[model samples]
Target: MSSTHAVNKTIQEINEKIKKGTAVVLNAEEMIDVVRKKGKVQAAKDVDVVTTGTFSPMCSSGVLFNIGQTMPPTIKTSHVWLNGVPCYGGLAAVDSYLGATEPAEDDPLNKVYPGQFKYGGSHVIEDLVRGKVVHLRATAYGTDCYPRRELSRDITLADLPEALLLNPRNCYQNYNCAVNLTSRLIYTYMGPLKPNAKNANYATAGQISPLFNDPYLKTIGLGTKIFIGGAQGYVLGAGTQHVANPERNERGIPLSGAGTLMLKGDLKKMDERYLRGVSVVGYGTSLCVGVGIPIPILNEEMAWFTGVSDEDIDMPVKDYGYDYPNRLPRILKHAKFSELVSGEIELDGKKVPTVPLTSYTRSLEIANELKKWISEGSFTLTEAQEEIPSN
Candidate 1:
């Protein structure tokens, strides 16, 4: 067997082939078919890169805005608001962080509107990115050098020197399917859960997930370029609560939550369709982020990893009805994405329908789009500047 460091050599070979117009690249879906027809050995020899992608509701997301100078008498703002939702004003006078799930201060729990977070931080960011004027208000104590007490203005993304969607946590490697056994329906970020185990809702892009294809974080790390919301982006680091260690099957696929990514991209270049403002019933609002990462087929092992089928990826089914304050929910059973996508799974001797909160169709579109970019030389792979933590 070749040393794992062969990845560097493979990168050089791919670059040389690209210059000669002889490189072979494929998306995750197409690579799966090729592997199935020709086996991993031959497929690895033919394919140089495989693109993977996902589109899921990421709650631990936000945007950082560096709103430029406020007219004269610049005040070191102590408080800031974006579309009625309070933002982190601790950064400098004109910098703030707008969280995805943060509701307006007047309706913290969505009491008045109940689930329809009409003007939350995510919506404010979306409006600004779309070139719509967004309400911005700030208050500060008077200082000798900067003595402006309050300021209010309408601003678009272009008005800010830096408007970046820096999501601390976006796509998760794998997630559990949630089911409620209680008599009443419960709404959650995982989607609506029906009573009496009537339905199951899950959120993940199964085999097409970027971290899943690169479970060990071999090639995906800091500085890796990616397609984010139809615009180019890069990996910042390991996402918050990134579980470097998790129970895995024989194929090294995590059974549940595992790797995650912290991504950042220019909001001004993002498309509104790929960055959507979502309102979950009873749950707060969030951003459905579309992310695509191209995995360089460094070797045969990498090719096999990217070609993993949905049926081979297993995740647990957890009962959301159970309350576990300090512990995790008891795993009822395991089911594959293929089983969930089939629309049903057998649990406790009963057939229960399944619902996917993430859009698989959109995920495929992103992967194909990324593949086209690489094939046409519009996008090129970059080696990770820093490796991610595996432990």
Candidate 2:
């Protein structure tokens, strides 16, 4: 490495440059070209931060809120339901969580044939974020210290003391490309899959995705600032099902839903555009959350990792109709993102069309927006308070 290319830096040094408005920030797409043209060493010397983004329906996401004290100002809330959707009321007081995947209590869960299943916790959350009124109904076993038993009221997010976007597991580092091998169609969280390998579906922004840019999570960890739901958020920790060990390819990238993140942000500041409710046919309801993470180019290695391209990332394909539902998520074949983006993948020697569940266009917007904030000295990367577990 030449003197011009071989330069080592830190998050603090990058922060100083960001503060001075002299930092050269780039999105993951641009970083790919920079690394290709100038090489990793030169790219590391040139770029300070690389921004990445992903917008997809993640089921392991939800909103946590405190509807404030009811009339008597005392209610040991035991069971809470929002807009006919059952909420997790295990928390103290009027606090409850609306899980994105939780169905309504009286929901016609696929029992009514020839009808699309819709309306759930996710939709209720979207309504709140959009400033629409949400009906709140609760019941509790009367206690001495907190006596009130039953409470019912229509409340908006504005009525709450705090509404938080608290996601347990999100941004699965890698995921499956689902297809059906059986003779009939199958609807899954990945969306509707055509039978006989006619169509396949995947969800990821590829190279520009957050975890893809920092595969090893070298700089992304606890307390790392991020662009989430069109607002600033922090990484809480390694998300649920997150484990350090996983199967990796030659490039050291995981082959499954390996690396994950727990994230939190102020729901009050979130934009409805980035936080949306979606219902998959026969699958369930889910929240589409837009998330972006900026990686400080601390060294040549960081530059190289951020330059990961679609062609280089491979995710395994699974038969959602046959293998997936039977507890055997067998990898029929591994397909490249480049191929998936091309709208087709050759599965079982058949040319199957591919569909993406996430929006790359929205992802680009988020990355660009974050870049703009950083370049304008409005955003600075945070040094992780704790490391994300990785091997």
Instruction: Give me the candidate number with maximum TM-score.
Output: 2
Please list the residue runs of candidate 2 whose C-alpha ends up more than 4 Å from where it truly belongs after superposition: 1-5, 70-72, 108-111, 114-116
For model 2 the local lDDT of residue 90 reads: 90
Q: What is the TM-score of each candidate against the true structure?
A: 0.94, 0.96
Output the lDDT of residue 171, model 2. 92
Q: What are the runs in model 1 whose C-alpha is more than 4 Å off? A: 1-9, 71-73, 106-116, 324-326
Using alpha carbons, what is the TM-score of model 2?
A: 0.96
Count clashing residue pairs in model 1: 0
For every candidate, C-alpha RMSD to the true structure in Å: 2.8, 1.7
10 residues in a row with least lDDT, candidate 1: 1-10
Candidate 1 lDDT by residue in tens digits, 141-251:
868977888989987787889988999998898888999988988877787788898999999888888887888888888999999988999999899988998899887
Model 1 gets an lDDT of: 0.84
